[model samples]
Target: MGEERNRPTIVVVDDAAEVRALVRARLRLSDKLDVVGGAANGAEAVELVRQLRPTLVLLDVSMPVMDGLEALPLILEASPGTRVVMYSGFQEQGLAHRAMALGASAFLEKSMALDDLAEDLLAVLGADAPVAPTSPLETQHPAADDLDRSILREHLERFREVFEDAAIGMATVTLAGQIVRANRTLAALFELSVDDLVGVPFADFTAASATAVRAALADILAGRRRVVKIEHEIAGPAVPLQVRTTLAPVLDSNDRPLYLFLQMEDVTAQRGAEEELRRSEDRFRLLVETVEDYAIFMLSPEGLIESWNAGAQRTKGYTADEIIGQHFRVFYPPELQESQHPEHELVMALRDGHYEEEGWRVRKDGTQFWANVVITTVRNGDGRHVGFAKVTRDVSERRAMLQEREATSAALTAANARLQQVAEDQAHFLAVTAHELRTPVGVLGGTADTLAAHWADLEEDERDELLAGMSSSAGRLRRLLADLLTASRLQSSALQLDLAAVDVGAVVDTSVATAQRTHPGAAIIADTERDLVVQGDGQRLAQIVDNLVSNALAHGVPPVVASARRIGDEIEVAVSDAGPGVQPEMSERLFERFSTGRAAGGTGLGLYIVRQLARAHGGDATYRRPEGSEPGAFVVLLPHSPPNA
Candidate 1:
């Protein structure tokens, strides 16, 4: 009980349960130190220190809930007399100084042996604790002299084992720069055995870095520097090797440098990797700078232009000196800038990683062009939004071509619709023509048959009637055949006009006589003004008049009139009747091929042929109607004969 009361009390704190257990067990070996309690982390240790008020706290630097640096002042505030010693795996001198500045009693590495660790903790508590020797050989030997020698031999052997078996290259050099001792790792770096390396000058391994290595060694020996570090290249079997070399003085008891402790680590692979990364960045920058087709640049997170490439300068008509550092909104039109669209684009890109669109963008000269643009969020390795990468391409030509294609497609569709309507109309005309031919053909066949069967037993009047029927049928066939042939010629653009000075009044009178004979009881009139002449084909002109008069007699109430008069520089020949002419909707289509226009019978080709023949003579055909119960007229207008003609 008295020994326990005299011993210094300590609380062991670590994040690892095994470390806490090991520390507590090691404190028992000191016999002059007592383990009062154990805690897993700083927060728990703080509470434990407050409760027990232990003389010393073995605290870990890193822990959950709270860390040692934070808990150090709290623990001391809780127990003013308690000393806290920081334990960590790191051996950095800056961390040690920082811990000491934070009022820590001492900073010890976790790599320290258990016996040394207990002694360190006890020293922090102001207790002079003699820790037991770890070797069984020292324990078994009771005599002081034997124990002293045994311990000295054990320490030297341990030093030798550590020196020869280190992973990095290690060597012991004389103050004069000669290699006194070298480990197998160090020998392998120079591609030689330890026996060959000893007694040789360390500078002899590298011709280029020999002077630098000697200077560093001299500095350590002269006490100007306690440690020296440098990166240098050494000759190798295949290629040159890079090494990080550190030199420190191995001091004697008088604090004078005895020899140099050398440490070298192979860093060739690390150097190669850094060089490759730099080259890759250079290549990327060159590619972006030389591109002329696309405007690739960078923008800050606030939407200000950060970088301008050559491509951006060429495409935007701005030099790098002129445009860099300007707000990216400058590329937008005034309306978009006023609406803050450029700012909104950044927000959207940040949210979704990228934003892309094709729209109008303004250039330096204020001209607008269609551009395809992409804005992508740029992030750092830590995933923080840094800026944006913008790529713009002008696509105005492509857009114009697309619009032209769409317009051409619409025209083709309309033409196709008109062709389809014409085809339907022609089919209907063929069916009507077949019906019309059948009536005439049947009439002629029956009339002939009747004459053949009844000739011997018939009266003269019956025979005369049969002969008149045959003549009418034959005239009908001749008219139908002529109209068909003329229509075919007009369709094939093969119609030839005979040009001459034609008497329009004479053509009208002749057409009227022919129409009256065909209709028999139909009332018809011919009215004319004298000296109405036109430059036209006379036969075609008469054909035009005849067809109009015949159409009026067939489809109109009687008093069908054919009239010719001079109007300005043209002659007008008109055919009109008293009947309601045609329905209002069919007025425009009156002269279309196969348009019968309310006619009860007859082929629908007369007016179509009339307009075609009229247009051939540098003239036109039109329909005229006066309002309020007035009659409609099909009028053909022909140019007046030239003065010379």
Candidate 2:
């Protein structure tokens, strides 16, 4: 009667048969408590606890028949004094707290200490003895008396169950990285089993993961590193596993570290799937951002700016802050609002696939710039419209430069046409002038030769008259030749003048004398001047005066007069004749090349040579009407170069 009264009854409840069997097998030999019955569901366990009147109930928190919480109130109603110890696979803090509030004695994890469970039961039973361990490895379990053999068998079985059926991957490795044990999970992952894996180095099975596994094992054993976790991918001919390996210290009784415990989690398919999606997004963004020609940015389907890029900032001159949340219509001129619909175009882009156009875009300052723009719909994987992707480029400078080039080309074409016309006109003029000049020169030369052939046979008086007439004709020929030579050289740009200071009065005197000789019947007057000086070639100055006087004699009717005078740093020389001054329309062109007063028997070159010679001396000549009651004057003006110059 005393033994039966002291004995305490305990009930074991779990959803798994293996877990119940492990508990019963380890606790059956206990002298303290009697495990009356075992149940696989919470309801059945609660009924068993009621029928047996057990002192303590070990109940599974998660069960198919009824959860521990759901069966708690009924179990207590049936046997109000019964103590409850909740059993669970998860140590969820909330579930444990709830169980305690519902009158459970304690919450224990499924893989928790059996020794602790034994102690908890004794305390609930109010035992006076020291706390007992529920583990069969306990010293009081009788098997402890044969510790060596008992521990050997218990440890081997414990290791086998833990490695084979723990759900999570588990393994034991020797100090040299050999695989002493492995679970079915590892075998399934690597296409190997316990027989093939045991006693083999971990690298043997993990041929692909050899490098990393070897390093991790070395660090744990020789380097004393523990609890190191690393991601690994093992590749093989028939099997591959992307896994996470966590290494831990498994020590002996003396507390020195021995075998390594490595746990693995397969993340191959999950991680690969995530990485592929991430890379696809990264590559698409890279392509859009790296486009050099198009300034791409994000926009709302409502046409508000969403984001800006480097190309957009460079092209549009607005930073992200200034443009973001702003409407696309800001890029249009205010005048366009009344007539154009850039906003409509944006709407069209959202409804359709995209909008493309070449037109003018306004700058921030309201200046218009030519631009090429594209606004396209940006969407997600489902093809639902998300927003707009806008690309803009400023092409104002390019278009403006193209227009300028076209205008330049047109100008060049017109200029070439003018040059061709001038060439044709020149050809026609040369032919006509050559024909006209030949007739007069040939007739005069014939006249001079006939007189020369009969000079000796003629009488003295007659010969003297004839010779005088011949001489005058020859002089005329010489004058014509000189005029032609000067004009030809000037036109050909081959005449190089030798410039020097000359006495202006002397040049005048020579020209007057020559004029008197050439026009023997006409009166020639030389006005008095003492000394007049100028800077010019002496011969060129003489030729200038001679040409002016000759021009006057040929065209003037009477009393041609020549004069020279000093006026400041210059000399003014004049030849006045009673002649037509100039034709009104011909005044500007009179000093031009091949210009003269006489049309018949004239190369139209005398006055042109006169003007050219004067200009070469850095002086000039012109025709002026006489001041008061005087003949029309042909005046030559000379400026003396400075003494140093």
Candidate 3:
């Protein structure tokens, strides 16, 4: 008791309620120092300091009403013997110099560790300041004059303002979980007025977070943790709130557990934003993987493959696993590699920011195909060259289709003897085109008419089937028009790619579902892994897959299997049927426009479109005989992108 009286009484002042509470708790750790009071603003601090005339005052620079700089002189004048230490989170050189010029004993940064803060505080107070009495019985303290009693009363009054006016949820809870003192914010949290919350158990307010809060409190009391910060749902007055809670233990002068100080901050809005951002990323990733008309990939600065997207998998013959970390030169033909064309392309891209060319390139099977290659320089945030973005499209089928159209046009203009046959061919071609366009439209129109005419006579199941048929026909018409427009763009050399990340597996699933809807009788099985992402356009990739599946179902027998799988660095999707396979003689002309077998309904252009779409994505569509059987199989292979690339 005698030593407690002799200890040098100190006052802590900060704008932050938490900082003030922390200072009080920390100061009480040493028997030589006693925290008399705390103030939120400089105005209150000046009054408190004047009345208390303590040994030292820890003053924060930024405060409302009056700042530390403005109140420093007044504090000094009010108590000539008191020492003033200026503290803040800011590390401004001019502020530090000005604080010293204004008679501050020390300028300490608020970011200093607790141990450093204690050492700096003790150093600033000086060794000559009052020390604890050596013995308990020696109660005679000549250092404390009659003026100290007046100071004690002033300190108690200043503390009352801080305890009641803090904006955050603050409370002093007993070790037994009783709330001895709580501010307006804490009471407001539980929907009660401050006056009515005097003896309420802290656990009552902590409905959902009761267990967590009690455990944290116990840890603090047992000295296991210095501070506990956790996010918990608190039962507020009007509604439940997600809050960040902090608990700190207040120790007595003898280093024994005394009370608990809690701070709560509502963070419900922040958590919602985080969840929304995660969902947005998922949507964007889906968009990127659905592409299938262009090969999109990334390379390291040294021209090594870094990322391969779905379009790349479709266009290139490698999967993400097989291609990543390997040099991009793997896609070049032996002649190009020997001539160092790949290196030259990189050099050109680096110099010009981009390089584009159309030439022949080798696929994984060493088969040569015509491709349009575009390489663009990639840079880091600092504008330094990091790598390159490569986009490639296999234009072989498009070139072939255009060439055939031109040849047919030129033949009609010349060869007068064959002009009659040419006109007949033209008429037949137009008829086939009209039939393809009118079939789906007619189905849609007839279904609508039947439903309108027999509204009362049709059963629910029949009506549903008719409505589904109309929808299916409408979708089919839309797809056909899209294919024609794409073909027209290819003929005019106006086809362009809009590349992004796409989920290959999702695109395959959509295509398989569409097939099931269109051909309800066929047993269409889809076997694929989820999250097989690649760089491509979703609509185009779906078109390619749908075309192949439709072709297999129309030309082959039942039990069609559509399977997609990752093969090394590439992705392969195969649609297999159990019907008669492609004749060996027609293998060379199978993908040619106007080259259909004895299929009853096609315009002879479906296979051509499928091949073109696959080629455009830097991939190829192939017709093969199923292993150990005469049945046919249609397959498309695409590339996959690396994770995080």
Candidate 4:
């Protein structure tokens, strides 16, 4: 218990559970240090330090939530006496310096042997406990000098075994470049026995690089370079092999160079792979440079253009010499450049591995064209981002053609819709015409049959009454037929006007009288200005008045009036009634064929015929409704003029 209390307590912290467990197990090997607790992250380590106040904290550098460097000061703040040693997998000197600057006592790599790691931790804690000796000579020799000799002999034997069994070729060469000793691996490299390789001049085997090798050896002997590495081809028994040789100086206690420690590795396969990669790159570059349809180029990581291919020159109208080394933003339009879209594209490519878009791009001559662009991040063999690969395709003509096709398609669609509407309207016209004809035809047929079958039996008054009814039905049929024929002629553009000096007032008066006879007991009147004259067809003029009066009587309240007046060079003929005028919503299409406002008892063609005939006489018809306490008027304006004058 006394010894345990005297030993320094440690807390192990790492993100990996297994790593923490391994460290705990390794630290147990040291009797001078005690593992008090464990943690998985820097935050937990900080809390553990505050609670335990251990003498030492083995903290991992990289961890989730909080890394060791961030927590180091906080841990020290929590327990000022506690020493933090940074344990990490990275061997970067910057990280080590940063950790030490942040108050870490030591930075130790995780790759160190478990025993070495334990000794390091013990050293950081300033533990005075000596390591237990492993050799049996320590027990046999108690004298200090004899014990030292035994330890030295043990070390020499271990070194000899390690040197003989090393994997790569290893040898010790004198300052004169003579091989003092060579390992089995080195002997096998030369296909000679270890005994025969000793005392041989090391430069004799390096015939291809003998002169360079001698100069490198001289540099090592003169203490110019601490380490020198060179590659040369060796003549092997089967074939020539590429070898990489490293010469590191072994210095004496006086800091002077003693001899060179040589290490060699066969790199024939690596050299072949490098050569093949170079050839493949050459082929790819040639292919890219010859492409004519697309611009392929390279950009440095900073977005500066590095390589421009032949296709790039052709598409962008700039030669390689003129564009290389410029920023890639030169290809973007002013608006996109202002928005930093070019730089944004690189950022997106680096984040998502690639970015693609189609938009306007600018050329060297300041012309703009639609182009499809793709930017891909280029990474080297180490998976480090070194630059970007950009591919651009000019598609201005194709885009223009597509837009034109879209416009044409829209026009055709609209035309087809209008045709379909017309077909539907025609069908409705036929249905309504058939319905309107059936009523009057049935009435006429019934009246004629009544007169024929009961002529002898009926009283005189009844017979006269039936005759009047038959006449009325026949007149209705005649008018309906006339309107239909007129409509058909108007639609076919075959209706011709007979120009004459027609009195608009006289026409209105005659039409009103006719309407009064047809609609007995209805109040109808015609008021017109004197001397209203126009050159037009008289019959068509009368027909227009008849249709308007008929529409008012059929669809309006009583007191229908047909009036004509002269306004400037035109005559305004108006028919109005005292009824809720044409509905505000339905008034626009009232002149359209078959648009009845869904009203019954009419063929739905009266207003349409009135407007068509009015316009045919170099005139137009419109509906006017006053705001309050007034009737709606269908007004027709016709140019008033004399024939040929």
Model 4 lDDT per residue over 1-645, tens place: 453346788999988776677667656744557899999888999898999999999998878899898999999999999999998766446567678889999988765655567678778877767774443443464463343344435433544687789999999898898999889988887788989878988888886899999999888777687799989876543677789999887654365766778999888899999999999999998999999899999999999999998889889999998999999999999899999999999999999999999999999999988999999999998999999999999999999999999999999999999899889878877888788878778978897898889889999999888888878888888899998889889999999889789999999999999888878899998888777889899999999999888888988888999999988888999999988887787878889887882565566778888999999999998999855876788899999885456
Alpha-carbon TM-score of each model against the true structure: 0.49, 0.38, 0.35, 0.69
Preferred candidate (lDDT higher): 1 or 4: 4
* Model 4, residue 172: C-alpha shift (Å): 8.2
Please list the residue runs of candidate 1 whose C-alpha ends up more than 4 Å from where it truly belongs after superposition: 1-8, 12-32, 38-54, 59-82, 86-104, 107-123, 126-184, 198-200, 218-229, 246-263, 273-281, 300-306, 347-353, 377-387, 402-645
Candidate 2 on 12-80: residue-level lDDT in tens? 887667667766655664556778899988789777877888888888776786988988877888898
Question: How many angstroms is residue 189 displaced in model 3 relative to the true structure, after the best TM-score fit?
Answer: 3.9
Enumerate residue pairs that collide in model 1: none
Ranking by lDDT: 4, 1, 3, 2
Q: Which stretches of candidate 4 lie over 4 Å from their true place?
A: 1-53, 56-207, 210-222, 227-231, 237-277, 295-394, 523-527, 557-563, 566-570, 578-588, 597-604, 623-633, 640-645
Task: For residues 447-547, write the lDDT of model 3, one tens digit per residue.
Answer: 98999999899999999988988888888787777777876776576877677888888888888897887777779988889767777778778877887
**lDDT of candidates 1 onward, in order:** 0.84, 0.73, 0.78, 0.85
Best by TM-score: 4
* lDDT of candidate model 4 versus the reference: 0.85
Q: Backbone clashes per model, in order?
A: 0, 1, 35, 0
Candidate 1 differs from the real structure by a C-alpha RMSD in angstroms, to one decimal, of 11.3
Best by lDDT: 4
TM-score of 1: 0.49
